[model samples]
Target chain A: MSSKIRIEDARRFRVGDGFRLSDVDPTATPGFSGSDKDLKKELVQHDEEIGVLQEKLHAEKQNSLLIIAQGMDTSGKGGLIKRLLDPMSPLGYRVQPFGRPTEEEAAHDFLWRVERALPKPGEVVCFDRSHYEDVLVQKVDALAPAEEIERRYGAIVEFEQQLAERNIMLIKVMLHISKDFQKENLRDRLQNPEKLWKFDPSDLNARAEWDEYMDAYQIALERTSTETAPWYCIPGDNKDYARAVVKHLVVDALRTIDPQYPTPDFDPKAELATLESMD
Target chain B: MSSKIRIEDARRFRVGDGFRLSDVDPTATPGFSGSDKDLKKELVQHDEEIGVLQEKLHAEKQNSLLIIAQGMDTSGKGGLIKRLLDPMSPLGYRVQPFGRPTEEEAAHDFLWRVERALPKPGEVVCFDRSHYEDVLVQKVDALAPAEEIERRYGAIVEFEQQLAERNIMLIKVMLHISKDFQKENLRDRLQNPEKLWKFDPSDLNARAEWDEYMDAYQIALERTSTETAPWYCIPGDNKDYARAVVKHLVVDALRTIDPQYPTPDFDPKAELATLESMD
Candidate 1:
């Protein structure tokens, strides 16, 4: 696939003004124009580039990258994190998994815990299920009142704007998986003993509320995907294709950031001589 | 103050085997060998060095630094953080304040919230109060059973060791203040309308159990001040002196780490030529 065309096609998946979730097909691989083997080769190249860029970002120490992964239970957030970050230095990246909020987190504004989890300068942080849960799960289950949920969308946009202003490059991705795809994933988890640990009965309840969850995600994506921090709805039925697309998106952002190794403050020639003398 | 001697004197306050909190004179300024003006000047220098070194650390991005501040309610934890981090870039630093844990945090191990608050690589994080509180306040108030508190000390040692193994420079400081000094601070808070918000009724209750709290601290410092994360007891009665001492300690750690700006991977000359051509 021509990377230029692939990037443009991927951009089409980005939520923008008047976008609709129904317009996206979970099984469609818009960006991958190649066979599976060729796609794998492309992913490897992206991974190598990401690794180098991450080091430069670390050296630059002026900005941070935050990737927020949100999706249904079987949509592969964990798998994506493992694959994307595996080639990078552990020191420069972290994965923060947002599970059930502890009582203390619930006491404050929903954004409080998320603010605490943001990346420091020169770091890349991924949130596996992020603050979007406040709008998604809360809205579907009616865990929060309607007005409060409405307020959250506004809060998220403002919060994301502030993050961008603070030099945090925020990428929001929703793993778009069909109901049938999710059912297959759930069945696989149940049938395979090794994968059974991943299964949760509560996931079935979420599945029952599938349409409600999708509506919640649709509204959230439409309202909060601003010029800064756009949301990309990745086709999750083809896990390998989805992973490659996400990798491309992340690499594209890194290329745009284009962090360079900072100039040395001290004289390296003199420092090297001093080091040799010490030996 | 002679910063070299002050750093040494501060070392004397670090909790080691057989250390006792009662033996520390909270009113003493053991290392300030100069007048107030000289001490102020030294602190300013330390601040400048800290700011520069922090930048280098951020550029290097191989390790992180975590500073934990623990003390009585009015013992100047907030003031110290503001003074220490004020000269540094906000992008590389974060401050996490631990109050009463919410119901969710309470359900997990005491270290769960703390682990969540740890710094990312190339970052400096300060905790206003940390896991020590689980043993300090919890033990003094019988908030947790004796056995649980006992388990926590061992857990803390192992946790700190793991952090050290992961290239996290852990510095724990206890702002030691006399009961009389605390009383004066509390009285000042009550009298000054501007400071009234800082006062909590709980402070009085804590004051009532002063001796018990000291005993708790004495035991805690003895049990958990491992070589990996030693505890420094900074006299808190004189805020300026305390701030300078903390500054020196932090600067010393940065010097030991000696982070340097990384070498460029690409040819800067060629890149500059390309950019010049574009312009």
Candidate 2:
């Protein structure tokens, strides 16, 4: 496993014009050329590096990070998040899961709750399901007026830009799992007693209209992927490879930020003497 | 490394009537006859077990947990919290660090802010510092009126009882460190460039009045340690042992809760068939 995995052209995974979901293979591990053992070894190293960067980010208390993970059910969003943050100290980052809105949340504008959940300076926050749900599920199920949904694209772009200006870097990930993979995952949930609690009968309703959801995601990805807050469409069938790619994305973001420990105002030698002299 | 390290007498570390801070040795590792290698192996196993229990707790969505870690500066509160929650999913638990009160926070009652940060059902919340700050720092520094500080003790008892009734189990741990140990830690912070950012000049002020803080903690522990929420004074000089004991304390609480995966309300066989038959 190389120390540098050629993240130079990571943008090749970004969504652009005519970015059809069908064009990308869900099973592909684009840049990584490693066995399963190698991938595991690489991930351990990534975890350690990410951990160190996260501490520097915390110590600097200047920039912040927000990773929004949007995926269809059983796309391994939960597992991906676990692995991405496996080595991080719990204090430095937080995971925010967005489910169906409650009455209060529903009453407010779509961005209202999201704005409230934005990361503070020095914090790394992950959104399991984020504002993209408005475009994906809402558009697919026709939960809102089509015109209202159309207006949200520009609103999202502006919102993300504002976040970037505030030094809150955003990594929007679309975990692209094939329909067959989702079926297999749902099957596992149904068959495994330990995992049965995760099975929801309503999950089938979304599966019934898979193509429409795909179209919705494609549109959202094209509209939302910008230089500041770009969306990385990760191949999700191979869980290990997908997690490794996401880890790289995070490490790359932190590296770009280049957070450093703040220089102390007080003299270190004098403080040491003062501390040592204390009764 | 036995499967069950006898936690039957875990309360031996708890503060009770006639409790004194000086009595318990900071270096003692009671009931643990393991070598350093054994402790490391045992921790890995504990991590896995805690992961399973945490999942069950999240699945059941019935009970919640609150672990409060209060210790003097340089006593390893931050490190202890990291190890305690290392294995849990970020979504299932939150680490809330309570620093000096902000203007808005100071305007509200002490418990007001704490109540807002409490874990919901099925979640685990850890407080690096907590409402105890009101009793500890407030009492030692005479920040509040004497009568007001005296009244907070009974209020905390009632507050904790209310939490217990709501099934939010609380584990309050005071990481007991000797003054000599703290001096060594502060000296390291001053010498190590990577650690210099953590060295605050005012940390020595707290060290200067160490005995006052200890007296304050002793009083607070005796008053607040009840059947519902007990304070565990763990020896902190041995960081590994302190962390292991805290892990056992958490694992024991989860075991007591015994949160089981919810029995599927929908028939699994039927759901499996339904999912399989879907287009």
Candidate 3:
């Protein structure tokens, strides 16, 4: 019955032709309706299901999954990763948080660090802030020339297509929080003693150009979201609702993968007897 | 009082100035003496301490940690990581397992991938197999010319020193197991149907050249173990003991870092009052 939750409706959040970030209300939970308690209970069930699906994926050892989380600071990327993916077996799941490029990373092409962090077969990898940073921050800040920024969008499409061809499923999510929501989150961080360490004064510089960033995200989502790797702009002002939607989407993807326990190539009865006889 | 445990003595297992892999007993627990129950309990305490230290490290947002785990097949690198590091916060730690080089990776210098995988500040990263693979497997297989192999030794020393200067603490560990122990482990894998996915026939090829691999490790350790990054040859025959030793070493390094709860730049009382006043 939970399978009937229709997570595919999340595609409604997908960027399509002429998609605008301004059109969507960050406070809207597009598909589901439940009290906070009910939503959390549902998330627990999804977690268990995801855990089981991951074990199957690990056992099958064929396909891989890559989930990319992109958003502005305080958009809840860390919270989503901690709550959703961290509970899974670390053997088969990895979380790669991309931050400021090191001098060494800067020397290489933009995608090199991203390519290096890719999931191996049967592994699920989440990118906290990913290659999208190049297009977003780099574009808004004019770190790269306009021409180069355009070129990267094409490059991302090709890179993601290659991954899909190699049996890697790609899920790109942008946590869509309103400018007002961001202000509240930033203010909360500034006013919490325990959270002060996470507060970077430089974030205000980004906030000053909020409109430019939204424009950058709009253009990026339009250009890079392809059949192989579609981008979803999840409404993130309601953190709990956003988390629920993400859980459903991930569950739906795993269900589509539907990995089964691998059949043993060798005779199981003989191996079991041998194992039994071993000292 | 547990801090009195000297994890540095793990260096007793170090491949010193004039060391031979043949000199060490793989079955021996060099610096620890405890029952399995006691070891597990101790590991739990260390895990809790590690959790606390990692929180401080994250809060401080300064120095980084890079832990390299190198071992032959069935030496329990995966097991050690799952048992020890996986329980910690995924927010501040990463596990990278390097397998055979891809065509793209092979295009770059040996250290290119290693450089890419280095930890950012306030993060702890573990490499399941690392650049040492270039020296170990590549040397044994004669994949590189003799001159190039010699050059990598110097490159590694310089590279590690640079990392040290950059404030990355490097802990290099070699899970040491005897050839006889490896045979038993391989047999166990072969006889276990559930673990068949992990059984790779190519591992047999590597096993055939065990002596050459040992020689390669000996030369590598002798060449690269410096004050900044030291190699500890952890006994792998008793998986529990190796894990305990690793836990102690990691805890000791974290204790040395001694990252404190960062002081708030703003007045906590005023901020708390402001936060309470907000809707």
Candidate 4:
């Protein structure tokens, strides 16, 4: 609630008809007019609120949340999750990061593994990378035949619609970053001994096809960003601002759900009386 | 480690020959010779070390950790987890809380669901309550045949050994709390609207058979605490002290594993060169 970005204004970042990935400036901090230091303080406040809302969500045990975070390598998906969910109780949430599928996973439909990982009632799960990859990476890399890839767009829309029907709210976020920003991040990983473990050679292959990946992402967004589970595109070059925007989206969704503590089934006075009466 | 309880002294809390449930003082804060304020500061320091070691564990991807928290109702299993794990990145950890089995879970062998929830390599999972319940609650409530309950102890020991052989380090913890402490906690939950959702009528039933459950826990600890997976009993009347001991135990295990940031498999210079040369 302390956010400078109103829920209505944050809607500007949502993917829509004719949405152009290149039109958004990754470095610009829209809606937030404060200094970085101020944003940090505001984030702490927002996290505290997220913590409370998450507890109510857990206590209600009637609905679940699935937050799908998709982006190119080094686009800050992991960083965004840490800022967004660490302040909340770990008991009420999970972070499931999808990697290149195992042999068993690759053998099934693209959504098989994803369906198994959806949040149970009263839980919030963040997907560090998700089924969106089946379309984005699968399409750009030609891992699947063109005809099969074309069919996946409708398959994904229907899959998400089923989740919405099941009372599982979906927050789909695409952390949009420029190619130059990713090169800087990859270089930082290569140069820092502490970060060297994160630098994978495969990342270079992905980087080489950045433009194609962008095109694939644009197509996926256009096809799948429906009214039920629309996608939000956050400019990720400024980690703080992007993280703040994600916090707003999660808070707004939780606010809409407005989970409340369930009313106790037994009378407290009677239960206390019975407890004391026990020998 | 900043812990006043040296790992050897902490071993004193382990169950072994002539271990008696009644002998241990649930209110004593042994090993820790600090004020509550000092313990609070020490816990923060320990959590920072946990955060760093956990990342290394994730990077290495050769080992995993399973922390099992078991205690009487209202002994602060959830609170201990919030303190011990929330400071770390949510990406690297999961909290799996086992409630009374559903129809499907009840139909399977007791360990079936737990087997499915074990941590993967490079991950840390906390079982808020776990397979130990099969022996504790099943024995107390006579949920299964006496002979069947008798078989579970051996089954559990063998199961944990399998985990240890697979490089999944297990930290089994029992939060020892006085009955009086539990009574106060339940009263607090009943009195507070915010916490009312957590108060269950069945908890009173368990409390009524306190002596029986204590006997059950003692028997389970004696039978199942092995070299591979030892149970650490922390005094729970003082929550801060209990949480600090659990943090130290986890930190010590991670230190023993001593996971390292993996060396890059590819030549970094050549990869960088190739990356730069790509069109």
Sort every candidate by TM-score, greatest first.
2, 4, 3, 1
Predictions in order: lDDT: 0.81, 0.88, 0.82, 0.88
Instruction: Give the per-residue lDDT of model 4 (tens digit) for A192-269.
Output: 878989889889989989999999989999999999999999898988888878888889899988999998888999
Compose the digit string of candidate 3's lDDT tens values, residues A1-279: 222234665768887877888998988876667677766775666887898888789889799899899988899998887777744777788888898999999999999999998988899988999999999999999999999999999999999999989989988999999877887887887776566777776677787788899999999999998887999998999887777788777888888899887876656456545444543
Query: Which wins on TM-score, candidate 2 or candidate 3?
Result: 2
- Which has the better DockQ: candidate 3, or candidate 4? 4
| Reference-based TM-score of each model | 0.54, 0.97, 0.73, 0.96
For model 3, the docking class works out as incorrect
Query: What lDDT tens digits, residue by residue, belong to model 4 across residues B23-75?
Result: 99999988777677787876676767788999999999999999999999999
Of the candidates shown, which would achieve the greatest DockQ relative to the real structure?
2
Runs of candidate 1 with Cα error greater than 4 angstroms are A1-279, B1-5
* TM-score of model 3 vs. true structure: 0.73
Q: Could you give candidate 2's per-residue lDDT for residues A131-216 as a string of tens digits?
A: 99998898998999999999999999999999999999999999999999999999999888899898887788899989898889
Cα misplacement distance, residue B200 of candidate 1 (Å): 0.8
Off by over 4 Å in 2: A1-5, B1-5
- Flag clash pairs in model 2: none
**Taking the tens digit of each residue's C-alpha lDDT, what string does model 2 give over B12-68?**
788877888889899887877768887676565678889999999998899999999
The lowest-lDDT stretch of 10 consecutive residues in candidate 3 chain B is B1-10
Clashing pairs in 1: A102-B104, A103-B104, A104-B102
* lDDT measured at residue A36 in model 4 versus the true structure, 0 to 100: 79
| Model 1 Cα shift for residue B2 (angstroms) | 8.4
DockQ of each: 0.02, 0.83, 0.23, 0.75
Q: Give the winner by lDDT: 2 or 4.
A: 4
